[model samples]
Target: MTSQARRKKVAWGITGAGHYLTESFDLFVQFKDTFGVEVSITTFVSRAAEEVARVYGLFHYLQTISPGDYMEEVILESAQGWSYPKTGRFSRGNYDALFISPTTSNTVAKIAYGIADSLITNAVAHAIKGGIPVFLVPVDIEGRIESPVPYFINRDICVGCERCQEACPHDAINEQIDYLKCTGCGLCKDICDYNAIQGGQVMLVVRDIDKQNVKRLRKMERITVLDDPSQLERALRNVLTEEAG
Candidate 1:
């Protein structure tokens, strides 16, 4: 491994929203494989992100994907005797940028309103204060987006089996699913051997405040709002290519 001086550092914060979680994970692998030698990337997961990943059966996968680091609202101050010292990388100029992909409306609103209560929020706050670049992909920017998720279950095929319930880390299902808690990770669908979980879609309604926050996000010089997951790859590729050039 090269020394810190030689590699560009990047911090990636994953939120609770599952709109593009799988797609974002694929992109992470692509980024690492393509730029492993040139960049040092650290991943931070929110508490909600951990729950959603478990629901998607990605709990183990997340750990194996990278050298892992996570932050929750409860554990604010760490050994550094400061809350969110990880963002210190930005202030110290150790990191080139921060990327928050698939940012939930909650996260986007908090960042736009200067709410730095959560780990991810605090990191973004510190990063922007430090003049570091922040690239974010908001899930609710389109106002109404078609999210392909497991929206239904074929009860006849379920057979009263509790495997799907057991597989759900968020306790979002019993005989029926609890929509409020479900992050649409599809882990229940993945674990059901009887094919009871049918594939479906849901139309997410974006809030007016979220739209306003997007507007606020647009005005920030340090923040770049990516239209979607694919655009993130192109954006990073372009920047890295320019740096190389």
Candidate 2:
């Protein structure tokens, strides 16, 4: 009888940025079955990321991906206290590597400056200290980017019926979309008798400081900066290949 190879475990961190959230999640789902080798992903979501995931309708999706354990499979910053004890897994040699995809400019700055305040940031620090390779895809690496917005309302189409507002579970709708409160459940859009609510992509110009931060991250030790989220699969494959060699 032949024995099956042990699955490679990876730590994936998520931030508040919505640019590549969907794409990153899609890639995450494929990690378990698509990779040549068996791969197990443990997702670590920042507090703001939890909100963004909810707004994007991906919070539940993440839960579905890894339902085995709470902190073991899906670690949320909200549940972790000031110490972020779970990050110790990296120093204990638990994860093969760390991947922070669709990272926000704020997170990039924090990591570049060696700030370990948040759960994801602390994980990066431990991953580096433990000699584990870290890969990141900064959303603002380029000068400009077309990012997806979770929801929007066309006032012209809206009749001020307040039906959408009443239907909103998160109370994200009033006169306009209060992004901070919205979880992108799309319930308001679905309940609206008129077609006022909608969602689409938008173009954003990356600040010069953010671009510089990405440059700084590239020069950091044990960190690989990817051009875009699409390159994640290839970069990870190369890392695993090098490890096997």
Candidate 3:
């Protein structure tokens, strides 16, 4: 049997779409239990994802379970404040596969257009450039999906400290909140000591191009597209089996 230290590694990137965020973590837990010491799993998350996970009440699951699996921190900024060296793990052969789950529409658009502004986007871009295989699970693949929307529960409790605004990665919070830019990560609710924030659900309407772009992504070389969250375990099994062969 191969030693745990010598096990192949997988880089899992989480984005800020609440549609399947909870399902994604459940899939990861199963992947870890099945793979055992055969694979090392590290998770990288976007700023928006951090917020969304907190909003959806799944961040605690990630935080508590990740350390045991060698999961890395939730990366909010670029590695060097400009470029993402975390992708170096893939470039240097440290990571055998790249998996991005519950991919936000914003991330899909960025990847489709070859944009790499955020950590998740940059990691995917670099992995593709390096000829590494990428597994993507886009939330808005076909039609409308339910997503979370977070807001202040009581204006009276808000102290005008701007902590929630600062915590928001998408700049979605201002004197007036911008729902379109919000990822609904719900970090603000945790940050607000006064208990002034709350999370709600809304249906996110996907545009024609949103669906078309994801379809186009499926045609890309070395990119395995997954529409169902349950397929994640199957996909990881395939990757590990291929490597073992």
C-alpha local distance difference test of each model: 0.73, 0.84, 0.75
The residue pairs found clashing in candidate 1 are none
- Best model number under lDDT: 2
Arranged by lDDT with the best first, the candidates are: 2, 3, 1
Worst 10 residues of 3 by lDDT: 70-79
**Candidate 1 residue lDDT tens string, 1-245:** 33533565667788888788878878877787788666657776777776665455454544444554332112212222336666666676555677888799999999998898777888788888887788999998956887756446788788887898999887988788876577667788889888898765688888888889989999977899998999889876655544521
Cα error, residue 204 of model 1, in Å, equals 1.7
Cα lDDT, model 1, residue 45: 74
Q: Count the backbone clashes (under 3 Å) in each candidate.
A: 0, 1, 4
Against the true structure, what is each candidate's TM-score? 0.77, 0.90, 0.73
- 1 or 3: which has the higher lDDT? 3
Ranking by TM-score: 2, 1, 3
RMSD of 3: 6.1
Better of 1 and 3 by TM-score: 1
Residues 118-193, candidate 3, lDDT per residue (tens digit)? 8888888778877778999998887677875556456776778888888888787886566656555667777888
